[model samples]
Target: MYKIYNTILDFSDYLKYDFLSLSDKPVTQTPTSISIQFHQKPESNFVWIDSRDYPGLFASGYSNDPTELWKCLNDAILSYFGVPRYEAKKRGLPYSLPLPNGQAIVQQDAQKYAGA
Candidate 1:
């Protein structure tokens, strides 16, 4: 299995390629051995792998170890494309793989009313 982070949507075209052409199913279908191809829908920022009909393997992100997931996916992409890790680092090819992170603001109380 191979994983590609697809930060700047560079590998978006590959997503349309047949990843399971050679084999009926992925050689290995574990969290660490599954392949990932991330691509955003038109006019969208989220990339999703719809494993609805897929059997054998899938890709998922970990909430606790987001950094590791990014690193691993980037590495896999570089390797699959036969690009040197150092060159990619120097060129900043990975672009920007955004993690599902954000903050929620809450209003504890409304403005205090004047003393009555």
Candidate 2:
């Protein structure tokens, strides 16, 4: 499934963007920090990846493995920023674990999760 089933990110309701109108965007810029916005479903794990100061992106995934969800979030963010997957392995998508009840369960580790 490539890990995409559901997702979300915090964004202002008033702002707008023309993502389809993208041009001259960096094909591969230095990767940025990211995080997983996670919520628990009755029988599954849910994760959301997005940034408040950036685009109104909301990429989500459902699974039992948190690592898989984190990888999903990482890919979404990388693609959104025009950062290639190969670059993620190098520069890495530095981020923390899923947030359940607005708290992180694991310490941030880009080294272990990058290109994971």
Candidate 3:
């Protein structure tokens, strides 16, 4: 599972990519990872993950301990890609490959939300 904490994704093409891709369906990939960067409000515990390539798409975390905010970003992306919240939480996001012909694997991993 990949954590989208302080890394900024340069691939604006997947600006719609969701941290929602953190999953446990089969645990197999090409061993690739994306770097993440984020922004935090100066006065509060508000944090956000925005992308230059993914304009209008962003993920934020605001909980006191601050681990579930990224989940919101995943929700936004799944919804953008037409996945409902209930279903996503239940079975996790679907697996897919990337790029112009690829899809972001944003899954709401239970462990991630559990703050593992």
Candidate 4:
């Protein structure tokens, strides 16, 4: 099955909360491969390919590995803050595509979270 981490509010805010609350005992297992696309975004950024399926969204600081996840989360935070020439550029925003290895996935620019 496919899982999606929809950012209900500001991506930064959600990420921040997740980091602070769940960082201690982060979900170590990899999440099922899914397409995560940010609201009001042009394209899907990241592709998470794991076997486990995460049912909810994760906060920024929350991670199984505080150190490693922190690095990635920090980079994501920086990119969201619009830091010029940041390593995690716009294309690095938290977005995913849900599809099997042999299947094709297409990105939609329309409003998918309008009424949700």
Candidate 5:
């Protein structure tokens, strides 16, 4: 379980860093509004705690089985970067501010987790 928890911590840290960077973007189009966009379908990629229509990846029986560590890892990745439950259910892509360096930070993190 230590590996699982470590993975979660690392993923959470990456997300927090990425989101904070995203929040720092300068607003342009709408002075009082903030807009974010994503390249993938959030629902198909990740699961949020509040999601209803699609049960979370972990909610599936496979995720809970100790033998299915890969499933847990996949679920964690989805939960970390996928769209929030309310929005994902509406077919919304996950929203994050684009990083100034144009780096795909989330994808990198996912890869790191997978490779580990």
Candidate 6:
């Protein structure tokens, strides 16, 4: 059976690391105000959790199988660094991150997630 879960990031951590984000429309507010409301989307490309529990602190992923769940989470992180899931699995690496002077190369596939 699948269960709901959450992931969180510290404000300081978010500030220090580069991540991906998407924008959301604000709730009711005055038109004259300069401030606007924004919600942080999942930095991961594979999954995103939109919850109201903790504002920007609480995020979640849902899956019945633990392995699949972790894979999705890992995939999301890897995609952020422009790595595909297949490459990470082949190299036996949790995920791939670009090095300052090194590049991670992945061949284009006709179908994504198709096993060799």
Best by TM-score: 2
Better of 2 and 4 by TM-score: 2
Q: Assess candidate 5 and give its lDDT.
A: 0.34
Tens digits of per-residue lDDT for model 6, 1-116 = 12222113333333333233322323222112111122334553333332243233222343223344334434544443454333343333242222123542233232343344
Instruction: Please state every model's RMSD to the true fold in angstroms.
Output: 20.0, 11.8, 15.2, 16.6, 16.9, 19.1
State the weakest 10-residue window (summed lDDT) of model 1. 105-114
TM-score of each: 0.31, 0.46, 0.41, 0.21, 0.19, 0.26
Task: Output the number of the lDDT-best candidate.
Answer: 2
User: Which digits, one per residue and each the tens of the lDDT, describe model 2 over residues 1-116?
Assistant: 33332111111111221333323445475334553344455655654555665666556666546566665666666667776433444445455455564555343455654334
lDDT of 3 at 55: 56
Better model by TM-score, 2 or 6?
A: 2
Q: Is 1 or 4 the stronger prediction by lDDT?
A: 1
Task: Write model 4 residue lDDT over 1-115, tens digit each, in one string.
Answer: 1223334334554464444543343323222233332222124433322222333433232222333332343344344344433123222333333233344323222133122
Writing each residue's lDDT as its tens digit, candidate 1 over 61-99 gives 444554444555544544544554323443332423444
Point out where model 2 deviates above 4 Å: 1-47, 101-116
**What is each predicted model's overall lDDT from 0 to 1?**
0.37, 0.50, 0.45, 0.33, 0.34, 0.32
- What is the per-residue lDDT of model 5 for residues 9-81, given as tens digits with 9 covering 90 to 100? 6566556545455335332121121222222334453322222323342222221232233333334334544
By TM-score rank, best first, the candidates go: 2, 3, 1, 6, 4, 5
lDDT, residue 13, candidate 1: 30
**Which stretches of candidate 4 lie above 4 Å from their native place?**
1-64, 86-116
lDDT of 3 by residue, 1-116 (tens): 14443123323212333444543344222212223346778988777765465456566766353335545655555554555333444334332212222434354455554455
Whole-model lDDT, model 6: 0.32
Give the higher-lDDT candidate: 4 or 6: 4
Error of 6 at 103 (Å): 34
Candidate 2 weakest ten by summed lDDT: 6-15
Give the CA lDDT, 0 to 100, for residue 4 in model 3. Answer: 48
For candidate 6, give the lDDT of residue 50. Answer: 27
Candidate 1 Cα outliers beyond 4 Å, as residue runs: 1-61, 98-116
Backbone clash numbers for all candidates listed? 0, 3, 16, 16, 0, 1
